[model samples]
Target: MAVMTSQALWDFGRGSGVVALVLLTLSMVLGIATRSGRPAPWLPRFAVAETHRNTSLLATVFLVLHVGLLLFDPYAQLRIFDLVFPFVGNYRPFWQGLGTVALDLMIALVVTSLLRTRIGLRTWRGIHWAAYGLWPIALVHALGTGTDSFSAWFLVLAIVCVAAVLGALGWRLSARFTERRAVAPTMEVRV
Candidate 1:
């Protein structure tokens, strides 16, 4: 691996990108399942929720590897700080900011989630919703930052991935935030 040729390194980078895509898909599925109210039959609610958390963790790992490889690939010329700070990457600042935004949102989601039991329930719920915003920024990062953005195949795949994740989120929101669940009847109307 250390002595690999440029082409080999390039191939490895591309493979990591593919892995990131798959991990993102799995994370989205597990997130939806967790939010859909305790998994039935096969999985206990706790297990499903843990599984979803673990999946998101893996997706974060894949994201690191993906970005690291891209920075090394010569084509991207990305700096390390670009990962954490928005609009710092020289190659494509506006588009790259999308990735930075996603990273920040993901971090916020993970931190709030890990400390959920310690935080106020309402605060935890609000912070956890950052995952929804994270998803789209990530999708846009893939499209705006990738050289393959214009390819017919890439477009179709991006559309499919975005649609699936968002569709599942919609389903989860419907179940978790139903009218009755989200709203409490007031004893008296606000003056």
Candidate 2:
């Protein structure tokens, strides 16, 4: 593990990681908002989509910063390459690889999002759906590699994040089922 300096507390890279956390939270919230149910035909779908893109891009930016700080933090004995490559980091290969996987997913999300307009909607949506997987991998990495991983304060924070994610997912799935049920009756009547 690398040594920590009191003066190193305010490094830009660390700041970036904090910024990333804030962006990720906002992104998750916005994702839930847009995914809850179908908006009216007059609703501004483009705005919701743009907000989603901006939040995702912002989160990606912070992910880069988080990786930068982690490599230099010294406490984790990570290298710059470890940030990009999975499963080959010097310390805690199994857990550290989680971070690498998360990073790669983040990068993939960004790339796919940037090309979303060029790609067809279905293809874009399919690739973007992978963010769900990336989100939990990231949470796991934080629990395993983060400096405050097991701290009481961080524990509460992690719990809240996890709960929010699960609750949102549940709400969305329930809403989908309700919509399907409602439509099924209408279709049967038409038949």
Whose lDDT is greatest here? 1
lDDT of 1 by residue, 1-191 (tens): 54465556556665666567666776777777776565547888778778777888888787777777777866566777887889878878988889788878877887887898899789998887777677777778878877777889888888788778877767766755532222466798788
lDDT of 2: 0.70
Largest TM-score belongs to which candidate?
2
Off by over 4 Å in 2: 1-19, 36-48, 175-191
- lDDT (C-alpha, whole model) for all candidates: 0.74, 0.70
Model 1: lowest-lDDT 10 consecutive positions: 175-184
Off by over 4 Å in 1: 1-10, 40-42, 173-191
| Candidate 1 RMSD computed on C-alpha atoms after optimal superposition onto the true structure | 6.8
User: Positional deviation of 169 in candidate 2, in angstroms?
Assistant: 0.9
